[model samples]
Target: MSGTLGIDFGTSNSAAGISVDGTPQLIPLEGDELTMPTAVFFDFESKKMRVGAEASEALLRGDEGRYMRGLKSLLGTRLIRESRMLLGERLDFIDIIARFLHEVKTRAETATGETFTKALSGRPVRFHSEDDAKDAQALVDLKECYARAGFDDVAFMNEPEAAALANRDVMQSGDLGLIVDIGGGTSDFTLFRQKGAQDIDILGSYGVRIGGTDFDRRLSITRVMPQLGMGSPIRHAFGNDTHLAPNGIFNDLATWAKIPFLYGPDTIRAAKDLHKFAVHETRLARLVKVLEEELGHDLAFAVEAGKIMANTPDVENPVIRVGMLKRKAVLPLPAEMMTKKLSGLANQIGEAAEATLAEAQIAPDAVTHLIFVGGSSLMQVVENALTSRLPSAQVHRGAALTAIIDGLALGTTQAF
Candidate 1:
């Protein structure tokens, strides 16, 4: 059996959706699953590569010298993160990205139990740039990677336009709406003016490189790290590594922003050293994921608690403890800290949405509907900020982080 597929190859998570009876349904990543974390795991010894759900888990335990995740954001680029395993074997960043895509394709095919080919993937209307040139070279790298992964044909469309197509049937005559896709690395907007069921026109598109990952890093560096005073001492001993954003913060990070550190010279430094930072920051994500899912307690929180209380606060061994930052231990940051970070992002999301509207020549009053699309759109901060801007419009369910890809899958099939 042969079926066309639509893909949203996102930075933090990747999703596939299928069209059934003119209705779009998000295809299970490994079957019976709505989405796949766009993570990559590599066994330097076995050279085995894994992606999606299982990969997300294994990669966190990933050896610092090996295993890589979050390459979906690296698509269409030559920039590669280097990871060296215990024995000193190194893996390229682009290779990690290719392997993740391969895993995504393999799992989808395996779940459906079909030999399928040809895909239409969603592309951001605006790509992140190093020096302001449109990232054409990155696109070329991505096409090459997809081809190498065995797809016979690959195509792309504007992410929001594709999302609009997914909800095309919901459009009525004279329907006008806005799309606010707060994705892993960017917050994008599109104005849709529907003339008919199949004749939706993209009135305009605008975007900015801001989203969820920014908040996570905010918590890590500002809230958690400072609480632990994780500097100089840890750097001298542990080699200046040990960076993370929690699963909760990561989900927030998934809301969008190209970089984790949103501002300052430190932010620029992180951008230039993105590869190294990805490794360092992901370790933070790994720590949080492990503490929450594996330990089954807030042991992580205890250390963070001590840091705030007396810098030597103590707790029982079974519970959270302190004095571990020097030894490379975990902590649960203060709630108030995470909240402050969220508020900061909230302000940016609002400003970016307003600025995009001005650029598109559309006023807030002209917006009839404002929809949130992308995995990061699930963030309360993002939703509240975007909604506050469009007081008169409607914001659709963005829970289906996979919807954009699903809609694009349907659109590409129709485009054919």
Candidate 2:
């Protein structure tokens, strides 16, 4: 059996969808889950690899392995071409990504009881943001990845455009809509004019390489990094305390895409050196511990969970608990605090929204409706920024997680 699949290969999560007798529905990739965490783990002891939630589970189970997440964020960067030693074999980042996608393809086929060859993949409007050459190359790289994943032929669609397609029927006739898609690694905007339930015209699109993971980084740097000697003063051997501990390691630890690559000899040596000169040896010691224990992604996940709980209306554990750090430690990050830390990103998102409107030749007041999509769009900061920028427009919410895939499925019905 042959079928067409629409895949949203997100940085932090992924989902696949297909049209079922004229209705678009998501495929259960992980035990009836519509969305699967975009993660991979290579267990050294078991000599086996896992993908999605199983990968996360294996890593959390204290299994000896190399855990990698934020796979989509590697595209358009130099790391995409990089290689790593896994299970005694050299593997490229692209190879890892392709293997993950291949797993998704296989699971999707099994769930649907059909083989899929033609596909429509969702992508951010700008993979590199403002670098046209890199942005174009990102598409080429992703296409190659898809090919390696076993897709006979694949087409790409801007994520926001796909969301717009999925939600077009919700817009009023002749309404001008704006799609704000704040994803895991990028924020995309699309200004479109919907003529009817089935007719939509895209006026313009813009993207920024900042999203939920960026918010997680900001939170980590502000609330958690200090405890790990991020801003601690480094004492020089000349008896002067003028320098600060190197931030490269801390920064990489805070970033989702860079965490996997942070484990190395040079980094370990630097951490040790920092420990010797750190004004607060305890903090630097914690930093070294994290590095030695390979807890970078665990720290990132803690920050992410904190952000989510802080934004949640009623949550008992609002504090970000960093278990890898000193036991019984916590970082107090309330909703207001997370929002404040995310203000700069909010401004950038607003700018991107304004740029989209300008590029579409539509003034802010001219926008008739605003649609929010993607998991990160659930963040209050994103909502406030877009609402403040487009106050005159009515606000609409799409399926936070499945909108893009649903749209991709709908898009598959139309021309590629």
Candidate 3:
């Protein structure tokens, strides 16, 4: 029998591995890197599709292509099934995601010289926290994606639960631990008790549809979008009356998944009309330029970079570089301001963690360890929120990007 592949198909990044001699061995999906960014670029000139860092490089080089990130977030939405033309191919989000996953499988096979027939994939506890139907549909959609990616069969484990499994050794027998897996699009929690050296009993798992992307969106809406006339007024077509610009365009522009869809001709025309009727014509002109030039992804990248800079400690004068929009255009993003903007979301995550404990009938102080995994868990704001709620627990940082894949790989032998 061929081995079972373990895949962590994440909203921002992805990884794959397999169990070797009962130990997890991660594949180098991108030339010695265990994880690859979940991004794709459809090149117009070459009529090709590029995945991972190559795709990002294509976008950074200002190539003529459609660059898409956050493909995982579209799984449960209507947009996932909507077809669009890309590089002479009519494809939907599922097809796009399948291609990316297929590339991962090919790379893994090439690296390890092994055939994988079955898969054990890591997924969030809730893909759409507010909608049960969408959440369930997301699983069905992902299973189909795996099948399309060439896996014969697939099994799923909650992301936080996978992290919990991987970090079980961090706690001694009888110790209670909480796993906080904060990724690009979701924050997940898992409560478990370490029963033995290599085992744990899961108490509960919970997740919320908010993460790094949400932070970037909030920051962009508050700081960057205003420059593009997000809240500026527009004059009536035939009267002196004015109204604030509609938020639809600006909101989509700030969002990672929606940026690619906003490049259509209709949106461009609307932006041009807004520019023409704007009380602040200069600002709306920037908006028109962005839509016409297809710079929404670039703006989003800038916001993401600024978010990282602001999150870093002792960073002097953190600012979002919008020189791409206009020469010398920079937006200041102080750490305090970012915390203020994201505090509410962080609090919600904390409350979710508390709710997980409540569901398990456990007390916050009873958790002896707090294991943090995934990229967004590094944010000081999130740490503050979780620590404030469970101050007695000792915090341990798991492999930020690969913990889920590590656990999945370890579980692959038993998953089948």
- Each prediction's Cα lDDT score? 0.58, 0.88, 0.93
- Can you give the lDDT of residue 252 in candidate 2? 91
Which lDDT tens digits does candidate 3 get at residues 1-416? 24788999999999999888878889999888999999999999999999999999999999999999999999888999999988777898888998998898888888988888788999999999999999999999999898988888999999998899888788999999999999999999999999889899999999999999999999999999999999999999998999999999999999999999998899999999899999999899999898888899999999999999999999999999999789988999999999999999999999999999999999999989999999999999999999999999999999999999999988898896
Question: After best superposition, candidate 2 residue 258: deviation in angstroms?
Answer: 0.9
| Model 1 per-residue lDDT tens digits across residues 1-416 | 23666778886677776666766766687647777766654555565665666654554454322333345555543443433332344545555565666776777778767654777777777666343444675667667667766778888777877777766656576777778887766677778888866778778877666655555445445445433222211122236654442233223222222222122354334333332334454444333333323221122233223333321224232212423332455454343344455777767877877876787788888788877777567666667777888898876775457658767767655644
* Alpha-carbon lDDT of model 3: 0.93
- Candidate number achieving the greatest lDDT relative to the actual structure: 3
Q: Which ten residues in a row have the lowest lDDT in candidate 1?
A: 228-237
Q: Quick one: ranking by TM-score, best first?
A: 3, 2, 1
Model 2 lDDT-worst window of ten: 407-416
Winner on TM-score between 1 and 2 is: 2
Candidate 1 stretches with Cα past 4 Å from truth are 1-3, 44-47, 59-65, 76-78, 81-91, 129-131, 197-199, 227-339
Model number with the top TM-score: 3
Instruction: Give the residue spans of candidate 3 off by over 4 A.
Output: none
